[model samples]
Target: MTTQNDAASALLDTSSQPTNLRIAGDWTLANYKALKAQTEALVGHYDGNTSVDLSQLGALDTAGASLLVELLGAQRLGQLAETATHLPAASRALLQTVYCSLQDFCVPEKQPEQSTGVQVLARIGSAVDTLWQDTKALLGFIGLILETLVRVLLHPKRWRMTSVVAHIEQTGLNAAPIVGLLTFLVGAVVAFLGATVLASFGATIFTVDLVAFSFLREFAVLLTAILMAGRTASAFTAQIGSMKANEEIDAIRTLGLDPVEMLVLPRVLALLIALPLLTFLAMLCGIVGGGVVCAVSLDISPAMFISLLQSDIGVQHFLVGLVKAPFFAFLIAAIGCLEGFKVSGSAESVGAHTTSSVVQSIFVVIVLDAAAALFFMEMGW
Candidate 1:
């Protein structure tokens, strides 16, 4: 009753009794498609009395043995396989092997969900860990810079004067105009505020003292440091990060030159020189802007404002602000160079570290300035 094609491939007998599935024909890869199609809806049909008959089964392979295992269901196959001594030894072995392999197949369990508070706490912990790592990296980089710098300084023949001078022109001279203009505007605003507030108390003349004291001791250095943080810090990171991305830093190392000495030292030296000089210029420009505001708004002449400035604000106040400049410069340059070395050799990494350098430099400058302010206040300087 069977066609030759049906008899050539695997076949499942549906005419058998309800508890029985009879397999026949060659159970090999050549018949896997027809076998799978036949077994799809009939698999997992297990009642306690269910049975399988392989008495008429023909040539078999792993592919067809797997199909037989699925047809009988794994549990019943366990019981029926031991007593299937009438089956071909090879067929019994193949079925046992396939059953053993698939015995553990099962669905996986879903993970439990977490509460929102736990998620937030995890994020906070991650941030704190990241912050601690950054602090350690910054400190380590600072130590390397100092050690390399001292060694280079001792051997003046190895000094990179040309590079240092070029950077000074770039980070200092080029930025002078903007630093002056912006600080001048801020100074004018501060003076106007002081004058307006003092006028109500009939002490408008003391506005000269307010401008001189603020600009000389705080605003001048603070503004210059902040400006350099955004300007110079970003520039250092981009320059060094680009070199890192291009593998130029590796080339420097390959050539037996220290990257910290050849690259970082020049920048740190340039910024150390540049920031203090810029701070001085910022002080002069700020005082001049305040003088201009006083003349226009308070009807105070330039001479009187200068006299009040000289009398009320001593040279000590100027020194107090200037002393903080080198510290801020060193930290900013160190941070930029450190972040630059951290680049993972991609354009996006360069940009990300550049941004990170600027933010860290600014944050560090503000914190150091505040600490310096407090220290100087306590010292009565």
Candidate 2:
């Protein structure tokens, strides 16, 4: 049997030989060499295998760890009991994590089986069920919003008066110029078309009636709604989607603020108030454009155009346009806010919802307009 002194000396001699411990980070090679020399001498005095103390190591890196991993055969020695109990928990944990990652890099995991027809159908069914559940959730969300609105109406002190007023101004006043310009252009086109057709039939005087009827009864409201759908709807969706992506909505909730109250309510109320006003302004600009066309092109004169419009078009035309305005307003606002709330907190989601908001609003407005037209026609309007 070897004497303890001889064994210790042999162990010390073996350990004292410089062996690389592939470590990395702010340590010089000379520092690593010195540490290895000291560690080797200590290890040689004891058992041939011993845990190296890294607790006092001021710095380390992957280069150093890679060397250590190679020396220790991390697979075989990573979990061995510590010879030194004073090793830092941080250093040990770091080493273990690095070792595990290295193992993963060396070996890829097995893949799951590919789906068959039956499995694909099963997945689709599950997806449908999930979608149905989400639909119910979205409806419930809208209900909660309406309930909040009712509660606020019942308790005025709970409402933000300044915000509501500001929203109205934005939805109404800021939108006025675009609404006006679009309607004016539409009216000019309509008047030109009517003049060309009527002039052929020697009925050029009827151009005023055509302009008045189309603009007041249909074009103004429809164009205004579409504009709002494109402008305000996309803006609302993009704004809310950004907030969702940044986790600002979560922060608001944590702060006990209802995002619906802060974000959706103002927009909805603003649209409800603004759309009718915009419609009326659109009609005015359209008539003005028609008058200009008649004056220049048809020699009908602005006074004659206004007189004919007044005599031929009844209050019913204005009433119909205004009636559609509020409905379209509510539709645009609701769809925009709904799509915004649907955003999934990703960059792609923001763009998708913004597009969806505009598309949905336009579809709804057109559908509603068609239904309204059918109703008006049936009533012999």
Candidate 3:
């Protein structure tokens, strides 16, 4: 029901039916309180009549202003016949508009409710099933990679051999000095820590053994690969994201060129070619760094360091470390390129995907190193 009240009237001289309210005063809060009774009288006169006239009401306020609306709402709730009061044109239109809106709100409507515990569990089971299916798809992808690797192995000449060579020359040869320097520094740090403890036990000479064994087997290669993954992987993502934004990739597609083959294949091929070579370089530099520390702190001669390294480290251990590099390289390149393709139409999406690519590639590289370690151990390497 509408509540409209006015306390005073301004237009009462125009002979009007007692049922009709006429006001000439400015419509304000106090006016409606006085006119509420007159408006209610009109509604009572035609309680169930077809229509009621209210056109004579010169003005109305919020309180006595729109009782006709309430009258209509009450009638609709009781399924009673509705009435149309002769209201001023503006007032009639306003009341009718509000009446329509109230009808929509008051009508019964159906709504869906969420399920409880058991249903939630069932939904979770469905999600897990979907994840399992996606995981199977990922495995299928790995199988494809294995198949491609085998094909390339069988037909080395048909493979993108030049691309791989170029990447190796660029990524490995150009990166050699930096990778060597970093590994050397890392080895020095490791040797210092080992020496600090070993000297206390009068076993300082064993620092050489610790540095050689740890770097050759793990740290040197893994650290180099991880650094390259962060550097090269982020570069790949940003490059591809820029190309995607510029629609160059779309242009290639229009020209009947595969973006994957022309773009991704080269980077992937290059990293694979570079990783093993860089890992070998990293190990050499780390050994050199450890030797320097041995000469300075442990008083072990360079010749002795070299001779010990030659005798203690085997080709098999080097191969174990080398074998993991190409795999890590492939992982880095693939994740980076894939995330690049995930870029949307916004610069923000590109930045987010670029960061994700680097982080995911690094995580994958570490996990892969652990797995490789387990595999090599199982093989008794």
Q: Best candidate per lDDT, number?
A: 1
Estimated TM-score for each candidate: 0.77, 0.66, 0.66
Q: Summarize candidate 2's per-residue lDDT along 1-381 as a digit string, tens digits.
A: 111121111112234434322222333243555444443444334432433333334444554555455445676435631432454565556667776886677566788877698789999999899768755765676687788799778977778878878878877899998889988988888999999999999999999999999988899999999999999999889988898889999999999988888998888888888999999999999998888899999999877887897788899888988899988987788778888888998999999989988987888899989999999989988
Runs of candidate 1 exceeding 4 Å displacement: 1-11, 15-111
Compared to the true structure, candidate 3 yields what TM-score?
0.66
Regions of candidate 2 where Cα sits further than 4 Å from its true position: 1-142
Report the number of the highest-TM-score candidate. Answer: 1
lDDT of each: 0.86, 0.76, 0.71
In terms of lDDT, the poorest run of 10 residues in model 1 is 1-10
What is candidate 1's TM-score against the reference? 0.77
lDDT of 3: 0.71
Q: Looking at candidate 2, what is the lDDT of residue 351? A: 97
lDDT of 3 by residue, 143-205 (tens): 655566666568656577677677677667888888999999999989989999988999887
